[model samples]
Target: MSQFPHPSLPSSVKEPWLAVNLSLFFPGIGQLYAGKIIRGHSLIITQVGLYALSGWLILSQIGNIFIGELLLITAFALSIWGIFDAYDCAKTANSPSFEKLRTSQKDPWLAVFLSRLVPGAGHLYINRLWFSVLFFTFFVISLLVQLVPILLKSLIFYHVYIASTIRRERNQLPILGMALVSILFSLIISLQIFFIKTHIADTHIIVTNEMKPTLQRGDHVIVDKQIYRFKSPQRGDIVLFSPPEPLQDNHFREAFIQRIIGLPGERVEIQNGRVYINSQPLEENYPQKLSQYSFIPITVPANSYFVLGDNRNHSYDSEDWGFLPRPNILGKVTKRFFPPQRIGIVSS
Candidate 1:
């Protein structure tokens, strides 16, 4: 705690509910109002750090927002903690952080109102030069953190300089350090964004209802692009492909995804909707629909493959479009990421 003297107070002063509400929008404002500048600054630092770290970690998984849950949970926890702490301090009139406002000086109401409009304005009104400068620094740091997209930023980590230097007189080092850190974080975030966009991962989404009840439409999936480079897409593996052309209602002329129903040089047929390979029943861990449709056994071409969507009744597959050309094969779908409740690695 600072060795600052408390200004005397009158009898009728009420508790500082205003500070609690202010803390809701701006984390440090309540601490400033209660004369707990250091505590307010601490809260500001903590909130900014958590937010920046979250941005740096998992911010860029397109179409699915799995990373946002961590951010939302941390933010909610911080807000509640800050609000309750500020309110408690305010109600305890003698708390070191809460000081009685002097009526002879600028009204507390005016100070709070000014801070609400422009954060540092309240400090400026009180003629506190250093407080004004510091609050503005914190505000700018927070703004920078919030402005960028989901990418990892480390700018706030440099607050260690300011936190440690809070009590040093005539110090300009922390400010300079903060500016440098901001520039560095900005550059890093930009570079990361470029790398992610250019180095498109082996990630894709289940884009059709043909795999329904197993892989739903719009489910973000990770494909093992590297695996097929060494080995073939195996039986029952969910593979993403460059479909030859538009099939059924799917007009995609490029990448398509389906389960490899039969591998190279194998005989495949469907009897009463149960798939058979080489005249023997094929056991499948994945669900199969019962249908009376029968397919005569046919040998899969030497280099080509046979494929089908799990949704047999609705899907246009090898049974409809002949064997899936081997060139159309890309990689296998390995995970699902949409609909946060069921987010996990795709099995089977």
Candidate 2:
């Protein structure tokens, strides 16, 4: 035999479990840890590019539902592939043919997978005492706080069946019927929540004081997406819409919430802290912290609206970016339902 080591022999053994956990945190990290430099870099670049393209599509073409869904599916598939590929690479590096590596009785990778299903299960399987205890404790607390109430509610059906069977032979039909009813109820509720969140309305937590007094920071509100589909937005309506391209360059990515000050084809101007519409001073009823900044009279274009924030000086709105296109409007803020003391209809 030649005095040379076999080519398949690894310089050092790689831990399959550690590689998998790294990949779980981020797709390429596990591969990198396993000494697959080129593969790791490629995966990282691919993931970053996919995420960037998806974000651009979301911000620029929010109406393209099919394309967005396709991108989301693709990202998920790639992530799963990356995770499995990392595990396989680590196993290959630790193969018996390469070198004799210490093997554990329990598969750490299996433990990791099990942990995903039940928070602490994987740790217990792998003999990670401290982590297992912590995760199990958290899981128990969660079940007690959230699931216990639901279980108690289900007992009501059991009580109802008992009361109805007081004078007759008890049968399994009642229990089966209760189970089916519960399943049906849960399915219907899930579908309705999905529909409402996707098409009818959505909740947003206000993060800025731009619309102060009307909608303060930390306030939670419901945006009515379906209303604009039926009727055109009116002047004085508070709307949530994507900002102009130039404003986005300044890292303003979230949708802007503002009040419609000038409707299509109307002349609007701000002079000495007073808003003038079509050369006449508009009556003000809403709470506003007006600014002294003067905006020269400008007529809004067709199919576009001019918007302003209640906190004029603090807001970056149509006054800075010009008219907002009709297509850019996402929805109107209807009600605030958070910070219990400030919950009410958000009127213009």
Candidate 3:
């Protein structure tokens, strides 16, 4: 065996051999090789913690904050620190006595961020087959669960004349009266030929009578589907929607018109023609008379609706058909244009 003196290494040689100062450019590397275990751990922990916190904040949809800016700054700084620390660690000569510890090169944050954009890419790169498959599955499921339905509903509402201008009111209107007005305007525009041809749907109203006395048969009414689609539909707001059974049917699952008597999750009862919601008697302002023919009380299903006709005794509606599913509801009926004489704003 060749006799050779092992190159000398200082016992406490600049504890941070990797240059902790360079860590400001990249988060963990400087501490990793610097031999300062606690400090390095802290740097890595802070970087990871900050990144996680920023991601959660973004998912929350909380706007009007400087979080994004701060995150970007920290990320850039950490990346730079990592690059410099890596260069310094590689340059430090390994002593012969101890086996040379060749530092491993990695761009973990960069790889993770890029892969996350495509869902499962990073895991695939890391050879985590199961996690990659799970990520891809969840990604597809999320698109179907959230994005697809929203797009479908938007298209349905558009065909039924729920225009975008009024559909966007829920986000803008704070006062109830303003919100109601917005719904009214949305309805009026849906019936006009100009509006109909343009495919605008807006407004909310309830039909008390059959198409004959109330709205002429074949006359199209537009309802603001976006109002309650975003917020909760109120007790008096006349919502135009389709019943669940018809929706379940293979054909004719497009749209149906009706009035909102009870909101989702509320108990509704019709006794002797008069209406009672949650055991409280509902007021009838439009119909000339009240006839309590059906005696039934039901709790409105979640994300579903309870509807009725203005002409209680004559009209066939939820009392006869079934609770209307919110998904089937294209928009709220806001306007009636067939019979000129009966043309006026539909009231709550």
Q: Tell me which of candidates 1 and 3 scores higher on lDDT.
A: 1
lDDT (tens digit, per residue) of candidate 1 on 252-340: 57577778878889999999779899999888788656545788999999878888877888887888888887777766676565677
- 2 or 3, which is superior by TM-score? 2
Per-residue accuracy of model 3 over 1-348 as CA lDDT, tens digit each: 222122443433322222432353346655565554675677678778766675444222232114643675686687666655644553443343332322232222222332424556545554556756775666667675634433332222222221111111122222232224334544454346355333334433333344234444555444554444466666655655554775456464434555678888899987876788899988866543465576678899998778776656666677777787766666545554334454444556
List ranges where model 2 is wrong by over 4 Å: 1-191
Which regions in candidate 3 have their CA more than 4 angstroms from the true location?
1-213, 218-220, 246-254
Worst 10 residues of 3 by lDDT: 160-169
For model 1, the superposed segments whose C-alpha errors exceed 4 Å read 1-202, 245-251
- Residue 253 alpha-carbon offset, candidate 2, angstroms: 1.5
Write out the backbone clash pairs for model 1: 55-151, 56-152, 241-256
Computed on alpha carbons, the lDDT of every model, listed in order, comes to 0.63, 0.71, 0.50
> What is the clash count of model 2?
0
* Leading candidate by lDDT: 2
**Native-referenced Cα lDDT, model 3:** 0.50
Superposing all C-alpha atoms, what RMSD in Å does each candidate have to the true structure? 11.2, 20.7, 22.0
Model 2 error, position 317 (Å): 0.8
TM-score of each: 0.47, 0.50, 0.38
